[model samples]
Target: MQETAYAKINLALHVRSRREDGYHELETLFAFVDRGDTLLAKRAEQDQLQVVGEFGGALDDPFGNIVMQALGSLPRPDGLAITLEKSLPVAAGLGGGSADAGALFRLVERAQGLPDDWRQRAAKLGADVPACVESVTCVGRGTGTDLEPIDSDLTGTPVLLVNPRVPLATGPVFKAWDDKDRGPMPEGTAREIAEAGRNDLRDPAISQCPVIAEVLAALGKSEAWKVEMSGSGATCFALFNDVEARDAAARAMPSDWWQMAGLLR
Candidate 1:
């Protein structure tokens, strides 16, 4: 079986409060883009996993990669071989690892005839895995595990994503805002995300990596563009009114930075 693990951008992320378990309560509108990783899995004569692609070198430690974790959670079938094609940056708050785990779960279920309970097992691996498994626009809350499906009409919107190439740590970003209390997202369409609010982590993210602020500024300066930081840090996106404007802004980005523009789906 083969599946694509799509990357997601937080249209709006608001950290509400801290929970007893030390996890923060957050409300965010999550949207998946056309860019991300890919995974190919099949039954092997012997149980094994082989990953290859850009950024695949970093996943050498089997235990550290979520794909291995998801595989371990499943019943030992005949055998398995996995080839992971990583396209998204690691720890960029784009849910790359989680999406890979979700893809692994889906592939295993389809090949082994596993039950739907596989998603529940996926949740145990990571909070964002369940939503990644669904891979659609939705409302995520409570440490990012509670998911409610939203309208799937965002495919028409255009998005230009730019990664500053400076990795920001998500732990420190949340720790910087430990005492802050953020407001909730108002009920509305995904198009209203720009006016909803900003991610509380953006300030700390900028503090950690000053380049992020510059990226945000560059995107915001574009006419008819609404720019915001996705998830915790580093990867920022600009929503344009049309594909032409989005492509123009993407082309205007710095050559050293990583940028991709596509119609949101």
Candidate 2:
């Protein structure tokens, strides 16, 4: 089976508090984008993984990759070969790795006829894995594991994702968060969540990578839409009401930056 593991951008993020486990409690509105990595899995005589693609060259340690981690958790079949065609930037807060892991789990479930409880297994890999499995907008809480499904009707909304090409480490961004206390859930429906606008990590992320501030400024300069940073840093996005506006904004973006304008799937 083959499937695309879509990347996600945080529409709104609020850090509530620091847990005793050293993980931060957070409330965020998550939405999957149409752009991301691709995975192809086929049953084999033994369990194995072969990764290849544009970003594939960067993965030296296959064991450390979430695809391997997730596949390892499943019952070993006679054999299996999986290939990851990576598109999302690594460690860019776009949940690229997490999505790949989720896709692997789904492939295993389908090929092995496993039970539906694999989503819990996906969560064990990362907080974003579960949502990536669903690949839709959701409200995530409690270290980003708990998920409440939101409407999936973002057909008309166009989002332009801009990665400054600077890799930002998530650990440092969370470490720099000033308030560890959790906050009340933002009011209103999913639409409100998307339009309300917030990213708890934006300030700390900018502190970690000053170029992110410049990315935001550039996004703001465009009259196409509302802009916000996703997850930790380095990757910012703008939401436009329509594709025409989004295309105009994409054209206005600097040539040096890595940019993708597409509808939220």
Query: Which ten residues in a row are the worst by lDDT in model 1?
Result: 188-197
Cα lDDT tens digits, model 2, 28-145, are 8888888788998787776667777766777778878888888777665456788788777788889989889877766766766655677677778888988887778888989898
| Candidate 1: regions farther than 4 A off | none
- Looking at model 1, the pairs that clash are none
Candidate 1 lDDT tens digits, 1-265: 7898988888888898878898889898888887688888778876566768867776788766788788788886577788889888877878889889877877876776666577678789988898888788889988888898888657768888899877777888888785677668878777776556677888878888889999998898785446889888899988877888888888888998887676666
TM-score on alpha carbons, each prediction = 0.93, 0.93
How many pairs of residues collide in each model?
0, 11
